[model samples]
Target: MSSIRLFILSSFDLLGPMHGHRLRIEAENRHVSLWTEISVGAVYGAMARLAEEGYLRQIGEEKDGKRPVKQIFEITEEGRRLLAELRRSGLTEIWYKHDPFDLALVRLDPASAAELPALLQARLKALEERLAEADRINAWAAPYIGVTKRAALKHGQHRLRGEIAYLREVLDDIDAIVAEVAAGKV
Candidate 1:
């Protein structure tokens, strides 16, 4: 389901009359439970917040045998306009991807590049520490994870160790290449 803060409000505008209970039922019918305290808070909070923003309003009320009255809510013209603006802006299609190592490389100034060996060495040292920490974790979780996940977690743990070793090799090769180039012998 869409998680944009406006998702529920927009759906109510599209679908006819909808209250929190009806919304929960509809969402549950689609195999999604929308009744958690967090969800209830967000939904009622969004509805009230939007109403204050002049996008929605409490229009009617219904009562169930064992509960307080349910206040039905509906979207206003302002809410429709807001949704239209969002649709026009294509907010749903936007995304971002980031890579930490590539980001550092991109931000490297010439001074930093000249000092790259020390920086990379520091990074490699940190990685070694992390690898050791991961090994400790693996040891601690070995019995429980082995029993629960069988060969899967163990196989994945081995692969993780292999990858970390491979990263060490790559870092070493990078250091050598950098040294060679700095010496004008490459």
Candidate 2:
């Protein structure tokens, strides 16, 4: 299932009949780009694809002054069914991957140990900033959202905290490893 497809169908389901331009705006307002690989241009392309696939039906078109006309769309019954399926899959699926960090760490050059600590320290600094942002979001959202939603927000923060802790340990180990490499002892 394509995330862009799911996002388009879900947006129509929630926002009622809307044009692609409006959908793009709402998607940005909701911060969909932050967590997903979907681009702003992809929204229009997904809308076209969804329409081609019979999931979305264009109700009509509207034009304002000299601007290009906008095609208004609504979800079909099949779209609703697909949306439910996608939502269920999203909740139940665990997407595991070997991250780039692991690959880079494994490929680190012992001869370049002098440059490695600064690189890792830069990554550590980034992780720390991410952790801080996650904490801020969790704190800010806790009061207004439901228990489950709040827990979900905290889950992100918790993961960041764990990553930060792990990175700290790695940073500490980096110096020792660099020393050992410089001494030709390992």
On TM-score, the candidate that comes out on top is 2
Alpha carbon deviation, residue 40, candidate 1 (Å)? 7.0
Could you tell me how far off, in angstroms, the CA of residue 111 lies in candidate 2 after the best superposition?
A: 2.1
> Candidate 2 lDDT, tens digit per residue, 43-94?
9988998899899999999999999999999999999999999988877887
Cα-based lDDT at residue 78, candidate 2: 94
RMSD of 1: 11.1
lDDT of each model, Cα atoms only?
Answer: 0.62, 0.82
lDDT score of model 1? 0.62
Q: What are the per-model C-alpha RMSD values against the true structure?
A: 11.1, 2.8
Best by lDDT: 2
List pairs with backbone clashes in candidate 1.
none
Q: lDDT tens digits, residues 55-173, model 1?
A: 88889989889899988888888878887876666445653346487666555554455777677778767766756765675576566553644443454456557656765675767
